[model samples]
Target: MAPDWPAALRVYLGVIAVGNLVWEAAHLPLYTLWNTGTAQEKLFAIVHCTGGDVLIALTCLALALITVGHRDWPLRAFRAVAAVTVVLGVGYTIFSEWLNIVVRQSWAYSELMPVVPIIDTGVTPLLQWLVVPLVALWLARRTVQRNLVVTASMNR
Candidate 1:
């Protein structure tokens, strides 16, 4: 049997929240470690880490919570949340890369070479964009299926 669209959407939204929270939580240690390092370490860290990815991940979680609901509210809210997450994620990712480049230019590297920033800024937003539509479609399909089952049952 096909999955219900509303059900799928709920699951997907839950995923966005859980995934972002998990990713951010996982990075706390790394951020802490980086902060403890010297100034030289800081410069290197900024260049190497995609700080924007962290922000994007956080935004995803916030949007996910805002979008969750049992009825029409969830669907309506999904559109707004999805749009915000995509826009912010893209903007933040770009800003992160730009910051790394500027930091590298202004600061001098010690024994460690300046590393490239991780360009995974697009990952979270892209996944979110795909997820919303997929869930919507799944919900639609499920609704149709349920209607057909009900109709057949009534006829019999």
Candidate 2:
């Protein structure tokens, strides 16, 4: 049977939203927007960060789904989510930090932000990708699995 694309998309969006919020909250101290900026500017910053985070999360999800080899639902979910956490965490961290901070000067890290020893990237952004995705995926997986179990029980 074909997968329900709409339902899957809703799940993905839900996960991304929650993950972005968590990341923002956690890293706010490390990455502050300009305090003197107008409300519109601050809003733009918030939107930009949220949008970028959603894109990265979606990319990770796509890569995970494509790479997951298992036919079994639970195993496939576990593997896919784990893959997403690692791949997106490391890959996006390096790429984005370099592009935004080193190359483009899009955003500057606060003095409070700790730099990773070797990579020279802020620790918060790296942890954001790692922690938020894992938490979001785990929550989504549990919710889906629980619904599936209930549906199966009802059908039986």
Judging by TM-score against the true structure, name the best candidate.
2
| lDDT for 138 (candidate 2) | 64
lDDT score, residue 27, model 1? 39
Off by over 4 Å in 1: 1-55, 61-73, 105-156
Write the residue-wise lDDT of candidate 2 on 1-156 in tens digits: 322333544665687787787667556657545544566876677677888788778777767766773344333566665675568657877888889888998777778889997888888778777777776666656666666667779988
Assess each prediction's global lDDT (C-alpha) against the native.
Answer: 0.46, 0.69
Against the hidden reference, what TM-scores do the models get?
A: 0.33, 0.81
Prediction-by-prediction clash tally: 2, 0
Per-residue lDDT, model 1, residue 8, is 44
User: Model 2 lDDT vs. the true structure?
Assistant: 0.69
Error of 1 at 15 (Å): 6.3
Residue 23, candidate 1: Cα error in Å is 14
Candidate 2: regions farther than 4 A off: 1-9, 69-77
lDDT of 1 by residue, 95-123 (tens): 65356435544222232323334742334
